[model samples]
Target: MPTEHVLPATGPAKVRTRPVRIGVQIAPQHASYETIRETAAALEDLGVDVLFNWDHFFPLSGAPDGLHFESWTMLAALAEQTARVELGALVNCNSYRNANLQADMARTIDHISAKGGTGRFIFGTGSGWFERDYDEYGYEFGTVGSRLDALAVDMPVIEDRWTHLNPAPTRKIPVLIGGGGEKKTLRIVAQHADIWHSFSDAATLERKLGILAEHARTVGRDVAEIEVSTEIGSRSVAEVEEHHALGATLFTIGITGPDYDVSHVADWLAWRDERNAQGPLAW
Candidate 1:
């Protein structure tokens, strides 16, 4: 990517965020609970800033009927198993469960993790996708437009439920909204997310930032307040620096289960440390 095409500082509105961080999504498909648990421990031990599992009931690749695990139940256990490393679903389907119930569950997991150390839970969510996961799991497979509408409507309810929870959450849980849809998704992100995650390249990221910035203005929120997250799984460290310049701070790598190879992560982690040392706000 050309430096000229690099993202503007702090995005369109010039709002800056904190230091760069690394996250890993340990996909909970095609593996046993024991293997999944071990992978989670290994990731935390590898010093990932966050650990994520997708909220799905079936394998996304390879055999369609491969081994898979339930998300929230597994998350509750991970909350107890790991002493550190902020954890959550990479993106939980908003359509599966009731909005208020989701909030309550997030709060419970928050407390569970807090008992070990600082509350390390991120409420990562997305407008429900994956048709098979819905149909087989008994959810109404609504259209994308309907699901986005539901997301927009339910978020307010979810936020309200958080305030009314009995223990009131260990701290205000950070919400990570994933997707790159311009109209509905970006609007929801600007309105509610603490982190906005997307999988796009340098040029595309810059274009998306412009859209997100516009949405932020419409929602009366600072775009910089939401940390930018991107998947760095396939990109080289050199390729990632371009995204860093383009304003992505939370770089995530995906590890499929059964044979979760994370040897590649060490290179990215080293890159993260070197960038952080340059200065608190350096890209």
Candidate 2:
């Protein structure tokens, strides 16, 4: 089983105040839709807190032309399929769709998942990265700055559209921004995100948190209001503990498809339960 890898402690532990939650990103490539849907159902049954899919037109790894499903449509299907798990893209590319349209789609899915009460949809998004997705789809393949700039402009439009919609979202849709770019990305996260997801290691996360806090302060928003989320792929328990100590409450594992093996998931879930059982602290 792949376990969380231990890394050198960068500094003193920070108190974790939020409940620990486990998330899994089901990479929607190189597998049939039936298999993917089954995997989603299975993971929810295993008690995962969040389910995510990546936004891309093609396989990120393996055969470039392998079988793949689109993120938003698949997410809608998953919303109807699963009852309890919150689901979204790990990071939906903002460049692909119009801002109002994206917001409407998210709102629709939110309603679909609500069933009766609050929605289980989280809108996790980021500035575009993959060039091919843009090239083939004919979106302007602008530079990183341009894409991030576009994202900054579109976020408010999305939020405003949500407010104007006839039936506003069942609940305030949680916005999860995925990136670590200090200048533009983190600033946008401070302004908009309910959750900030990053792939930073312990030391990097600590440093970036400082930057994010500064951005939040400049924006007159409390940094503590944003949840800290980290990708904890194959890292050992001790490493995960170190990240937890640094205040990352949501830990995610990404699994790719074909045959999505989940034998190791129980280990992570056990760790999650253990952390929850113990309550948040600097261990």
lDDT (C-alpha, whole model) for all candidates: 0.85, 0.89
lDDT of 1: 0.85
How big is the positional error of residue 96 in model 1, measured in Å on the Cα after superposition?
0.3
Off by over 4 Å in 2: 1-15
Tens digits of per-residue lDDT for model 1, 1-283: 0112113654444433467789998888888888888888888888889898899988888898999888898889999998878899989999999999999999999999998456888999999789998889799988999999999999999999999989898888999999999999999999999888988888888899999989988989777677888998778778888878877888899998788898888878888888877764432
Please identify model 1 stretches exceeding 4 Å from their true place. 1-17, 281-283
Candidate 2 lDDT over residue span 183-219, tens digit each: 9999999999999998998889889988998899899
Top-scoring candidate (TM-score): 2
Query: Which 10 consecutive residues of model 1 have the lowest summed lDDT?
Result: 1-10
Tell me how many residue pairs clash in candidate 1.
0
